[model samples]
Structures are given as C-alpha cells and as structure tokens.
Target: MLKQYSFEKTAVQSFDAQTTLALKTEDLQVFYGANHAMHDANLGFPKNQITALIGASGSGKSTYLRSLNRMNDGIATVTGKIWYHGVNINEPNVNIYEIRKHIGMVFQRPNPFSKSIRENIVYALKANGMKSKADLDERVETSLRGAALWDEVKDTLDKSALSLSGGQQQRLCIARSIAMAPDVLLLDEPCSALDPISTVKVEETLLELQKQYTIIIVTHNMQQAARVSSQCAFFHLGHVMEYTSTGTMFSNPQIPVTQDYIAGSFG
Candidate 1:
C-alpha cells in the first residue's frame, strides 16, 4: 500500500530583493473540470540560472510549468499571478502569443519541422516579419550555435531536419526556441527521449545556456536534476512539496515527503 503523506508541511524557498528573478508565480492553482491538479505554487526563478522541477508522474510539475507562460489556457483553469518583468501575464487581456515569444517552450519529444535545417530556424522569424537576408542568416547561425548544434548541422543546412538523429532533432528544437530571443526557456523533459551520450550533450548545452537565458526544466531523472540545476523544486500530488538548492534538496530535504521522494522510498 502507498503511504499518504500530509500536505501541510511544504518547504518553498523565496529569493531576496537583491536577487533578480526572471519569473515568479504567486498563489498559482490549476483545475481541470472537477480535478485540482495544482495547489498554490509560489516560486521564483533567478535570472540566468537553471531551476529543475523534479517529481514523479502526475505530480503537477508540468501543469505548474505550463501556467508560467499561460500554456494552460483553455486546457485548465489557472488562477494566479505570474509575474514576468513586473507584469502579470496571467491577465485575460495579455497577449499569449507575445508572452510565448518572450518565454519559449521545448516539449518532451523533438518536433522539428519537415523543412530544411536552416528553414526550420527561420520559419518563425519570417512569420514575425523579419525579412532581412543578412539578419535572418545571422539569427539562424546564432541560434544554432547557441544550442551547440551549429557544428553538427551547419554543413547540411539545406537538408531536411528529419534526417538528424534523435539528439540532433532535440538540439534543433532548442535552437528553434532560442531563435526567438526569449528571456526564459521552459523545457519539459527535453532529454527523456535520448541516449546517454545525447543526454549528456543536452545537459552540457543547458549548462551553457543558463548564462544567457533563465531555464526551468521538468525532469523525472534525479541525476539530471542534480547535474544541471542550481535550484530544485519537488512536487507531489498537486503540491509543491519542497524548493531549495539542488544540493540541499537532495542531501537534506526539509520536508518528509521530499525526503522520501529523494530517498526512493516513495514518489
């Protein structure tokens, strides 16, 4: 039988005024029909840092992440204050498209377009009215380089993106998101579908990316969380059970639920 832990004892960390937060959520809740998938999830993401959201499946980590950029709209009722640059982006009148432009997302599986590698990166830019050949060329190179995929795919820019391996496809997806010049990059299990070598490459890319973009990753792998994230948040049964430094969360969790989850006794 699975043990039922109390939800009253949660440890969520908050940043000081001196620390600049790239994104924050206050009183964040999510509901789908009659189901409450997330509770009041208050958390802050420091600028130019990687924060990993780790939990077992169905623990609401992805739900809370989707709400950060209003991805839960029309899918779930999210009532909360999602503050990005002093703006409550959760407001009804906020432009979700614009919000997504600044806060990009990369899904679990790599979903690159059927177009060529160069076209894959330039498609969204062209749709957004960027027509300068020189600028478009620069963005394509820059984003690809940023994602650590330029060297591998630069020679084959005209080839179909589908021809790349699983790892390459995922990196191309990351390049696609960075092509938008977003401030925050949200990744939902970006490495869950790759080989060990590919996973290492993705992890290395993310570590480098934190110098330019704030990253929030939802991963079920504890080792990956410990390797890439400066901070870690653990979710359980629709609640954010703990948030702290990656070292502390894994070594000395403040709550029992977090301790058990980390110890592999339960999740």
Candidate 2:
C-alpha cells in the first residue's frame, strides 16, 4: 500500500529583497478538469542560479514547472501569481509569447528539427524578422557556444541536426532555446534519456549556463539535483513538502515526507 504523507508539515524558502529573483510564484495552483494536480506552490528562483524540483512520478513537479511560463495553457487551469520582472504574468491579458521569450523551456526528450544545425538555431530568429546573413550567422555561433556545442559542430553547421548524437541533439535544443537570449530557462528532465557521459556533458553545460540564466529543472534523479542545484524543492502528491539547500535536503531533510523520499524509503 502507498504511504500517506501529511501536507501540514512543509518548508519553503523565501528570498530576501536583497536577493534578486528571476521568477516568483505565489499561491500557484494547477487543476486538470476536477483533478488538483498542484497545490499552493510558492517559491522564488534567484537570478543566475539553478533550482531543481525533485519528486516521484505524478507528484506534480512537471505540472508546476509547465505552469511557470504558461506551457499549461489550454491543457490545464493554473491560477495565482507568476511574477516576472514585477509583472503578474499569470494574468489573462499577459502576452504568453512575450513571456515565453523571457522564460524558455526544453523538454524531457531531445526534439531537434529536421533542418541543418545552423537552420535549427536561426529558424525562430528568421521568423521573428532577423533577415541579415551576418546577424544570423553570429547568433548561430553565439548560441551554440552558449550551450557548449560550438566546438563540436562549428565545422558542420550545415549538417542535419538529427544526424548528431542524442546528447548533441539535446544540447542543440538547448542552444535553440538560448538563442532567444531568455533570462530564465526551464528544463524538464533534460538528462533522463542521456547516457552517463552525455548526462555529465549536459550537467556541465548547465553549470556554466547558470552564470547567465536562471535555471529551474525538474529531475527524478536526486543526485543530479545535488550536483547542479543550489536550491532544491521536494514535491509530494502536489504539495511542495520541503525546499532548502541541496546539501541540507540530501543530508538533513526537515519533514518526514522529504526525509523518506530522499532516503528512498518512500517515493
């Protein structure tokens, strides 16, 4: 039988005014039809840092992550404030397209286009009216370098993105997202499909990327959370049971639910 955990005991960290946040959620709740998928999720993501959402399957980590940049639109009802740059982006009148430009997302699996590597990087930019060859070329290089894929593919820009290895393709997807110069990047299990070596590459890329973009990642791997994130949030059955430093979360979880989940005794 599945163990039941109390929602009463919780620990979510709050940043002070001195610490700048790239995004903040207040009383964020998500519902799919009658099913409450996520409860009141309030958390702050510090600028240029990485935050990992760790939880078991169906715990609503992905649901909450999707709602951050309005990826849940038409799929689920997400209510409450998603504050970005002092604006409540959760408002119905807010421009989701603009919001997404600032807050980008990469999926669980690598989904690269059938086009060439260069084309994949420039597709959105061209659609947005960047017609200059020189500018497009520069963006392609800058973004690929940002994702740490430039050296490997610099000479093969015209090659098909799908022709690259799984890890390369995923990094390309990340490069595509960063090409927009988003202030925040959201990744859902970015390394799950990767092999150990590939996973390390992606993790290294994330560590470097945190110097410029605030990153929020949802991963089932606790070790990945400990390796990459400064702050960790533990989700259980739609509730954020604990939020604290990664070291503390792994070594000293405050709540029973969090401790059990981290110890692999539950979840």
Candidate 3:
C-alpha cells in the first residue's frame, strides 16, 4: 500500500526580472471525473532553459505537463490559463491543434511511426502543407542533427525507423518533434525505457536544445532532473510542494517535505 503524505503549500520560485518566461500556467487544475488529479498550479518556465517536474508516481507531475498543451482535452476537465506569448491558450474556443504545433510533446515511450526514418520526421510537415522537396530534405537533416542522430542514420534514411535500436528510435522521435520548430518542448520520462548510455545521450541532447527551446521535462529520476534542469518543481499529492533552483533544492531544500523526499525517506 502507498503511504499517504500531506504537505503545506510553498510559494513557487521565480526567476529574476531579466529572465523571460516562455510559458506559464495560472491557477491550473485538472480533474478526472470527480477526482481532482491536480491542484491549482501556478508556475513559469523561463525561455531557453530546462525545468524539470519531479515527483513520485501519481503525484500529478504528468497530469500538469499534459494540461499545458491541452493534451488532456476530451479526457479530463482542465481549468485555468496556459499563457504563451501574451495569449491565454486555455480559452474554450482556442485551436488546440495550432497550440500544439507551437508547444510539442514527446511521450514516455519512444513511439516512432511505422515508416522510413526520413518519413517519420517529414510526415507532420507534409500534412501541414510543406510541399517543397528541398525544404523537406533540409528539415529532415536539420531535425536529425538537432537530435544528435544525424551521422548514425543519415546513411539509412530510407530504412524503416524500427530497424534502429531503442535509443536511436527515441532520438528519432525527438527529431520528429524538433522538425516542427516548437517554442517549448515537453518530455514525460523520455529516458525511462532507455539504457544508461542512451539516457545520457538524451540528457545531453536536452541540455544542448535548451539554448533554442524552453524545455519542461517530467522525470522520476532525481539525478536526471538535477543534471539537466536549471530549475525544479517538487510535486506531492496533487500539489506543488516546492519550486526552486536545482542546486538549492537538492543542497538545501526550503520545505521539510522536499528535504525528506530528496533524502529518500519517502517518495
């Protein structure tokens, strides 16, 4: 049985005035039927930086990440505002498809389309009216390179994506997401299925991509969060218990609950 834990709400941390926010959520809440899955979450993601959401199982980290780009649509009731570029994207009539293009997501598992490696990256572009062959080719290479998979797969672009190893496939999925040129990328436990080497590669890719994209990642591995993210948020029992810089949060947590969790007393 899981141990039930209660925590007091601590103020979410903030970046300095000069740091620009790429995205933010205001009073966010999510519900599955009558069960409240996430509490009111107010958080900001600084531009060109990585922010990791850390929590144990069923702590609402994934719930909050999915709600950012309206992935919870048709499945749950998501309330509050997701602010991006001065617009509240959670409005009732907003175009979720359009919003998702600007804020792309990679799932917990590596889900490559059953198509050629090249096709997997270009399919979305073609569906969205990218008809120029030269542009598509350029995008394919650029995206793969951005994911750090170019040299290995450049010679086999015509081969089936499934032919690649697990780590390669996951990086291909990252390339697919990058092809769309999103302003923010959300990854949910992207390395859980990968081996140690693969996990390190993915972590390195994220660190490099942070220079060009605002990244929000959900990671169960506290070490990964400490390595890749500039800031971290600790969630517990549907509430954001604390948010702070990774260094401070790990070295000297402000909340008792955070300290306990980091110390491995309880998840």
Candidate 4:
C-alpha cells in the first residue's frame, strides 16, 4: 500500500459547482505507512468566509491543508473523496490544472523562486494563459497592491525577490498566490515565520482578499485565529473536538475538550 505525504505522487480529488461546498472531505483517511495521520475525517468548508483550522503541532493541520489542493498527490497513495463544488477531485476525469487554478495556497515558509519580483507574480498570470504584456502588468500591480506590498516594492519590480526582507518576501508570496485570481486561498501558517509587522500585513492582506475569495487558514497562533477568523475548527488526534464561531469557541465552548484546549491544558 502507498502512503500519503511521501512526496512521491500526490493524490487528488476535484469537485466543482453543484457540489454545495467550496470544499469537502468525505471520510478522508490518510496513512503514512502504519501511522494513521488523518482518520475518517469529514468536513464542509463554506465559500468566502475565513475558516481557521487550529490544532497542535502534529494534528494534521498541514496534511489536511495540502489535501485541499491535492498537494498530497505527490505521495504514492491516498484514498477518499474530496469534493470541490460537487465533483470528486480524486476522480481521474477532473482537470487538475483547472482545479488548482481555482484553489491557491501559501506555505508555512515564504518560498519564493529565484526571480524578479515582477516576474514572480507575472509567472502565475502567464501560467493561467494571460499573454498580453499590458494585461500582465496590470495584474502584477493589482496583486502586489492587494497583498499590501506594492508601494514598498513597486519601484523595484525588477529587483530579485530574494533581496526582500522576510515579511516582504511572504507578502510577495501572497501576491503571487492571488495573482492567479483564485476563488479560494489556502494558507498553511503563513505568519508563523513573520515579524509582528509582517504578520499584521499578511492578516490585513487576508482581510482584503477574503472579501472576494473564500479563505481557509491553518494556524497555531490562537491569537491570530481568534483575531481573524469568523469560524473556528479545533482538531485533536485527527478528530474535530469543536467547530463553531470564534466567539463561541472562545467564550462559550460547548465541549470540555474545547475548553481545555482553549485554556492551553493539553495539546
């Protein structure tokens, strides 16, 4: 049997309109050899709301996050149905490129390729089949402005992306992700590595972006989750101990596990 998270060949499950959800995992069970990283997980993610997946370090936050875009496809084996709109993305008939086009992701670390700042964002537009130079320039500017980094790097469009500070690089990454004009954004702890100012910029950028695209964030920072998310889902040992509004999850937790987790009892 093949295992997930091996970086071999990630498995994919694509779902489109008529699916009733921006994303859904129906009994998603993943294994890494004998270790059951994610149990029979079921979830429905709404469209256009900031949904935060908060949990301890190895609770499958990033695993589930990658599963959303079939970023797990590189692993040799994976089983389960992940519906996007209404179709199973794991099915072979669906278009992976098209599915990924609608779903964009940012990693825990800001991984920008060795390219000019302008080239980074433009590259995504080009991949999406935008060829006109004027159109490309407009999107590049727009995305950078949207990420709240345009004014800082606008004058250095041709500068190397590697030259920017950590926060700026992260914002650049966000710019590149949104340049694709995706309907949804998946962030895997995008602020864990940033300074306070940089983190604030990313959070602000998310606020600006979510008005148009549904956002799903996997964050360990309780404050970050508490401050930015409208809804919260707490996972523990592959189980969702609690799922509710931020207010309820924080102030009026319905589950003892949720209350303990919120109080920093056990991971």
Q: How many clashes show up in model 3?
A: 0
119-223 in candidate 3: lDDT tens per residue? 999999998899999999999999999999999999999999999988999999999999999999999999999999999999999999999999999999999
Q: Number of clashes in every candidate structure? A: 0, 0, 0, 22
lDDT (Cα, 0-100) at 231 in candidate 3: 92
Model 3 scores what on Cα lDDT?
0.92
Instruction: Record all residue pairs in model 3 with backbone atoms less than 3 Å apart, i.e. clashing.
Output: none
Q: State each model's CA lDDT, in order.
A: 0.95, 0.95, 0.92, 0.81
Q: Which ten contiguous residues of candidate 1 have the minimum total lDDT?
A: 1-10
Candidate 1, residues 1-267: lDDT per residue as tens digits? 667989998899999999999999999999998999999999999999999999999999999998888899999999989999999999999999999999999989999999999999999999889999999999999999999999998899999999999999999999999999999999999999999999999999999999999999999999999999999999998999999999999899998888888999865
Model 4 poorest 10 in a row by lDDT: 2-11
Q: List ranges where model 1 is wrong by over 4 Å.
A: none
lDDT of 4 at 110: 95
Residue 87 of model 4 has an lDDT of: 80
Worst 10 residues of 2 by lDDT: 1-10
Query: What lDDT tens digits, residue by residue, belong to model 4 across residues 193-255?
Result: 999988998999898887888899999999999988977888776666566777778898766
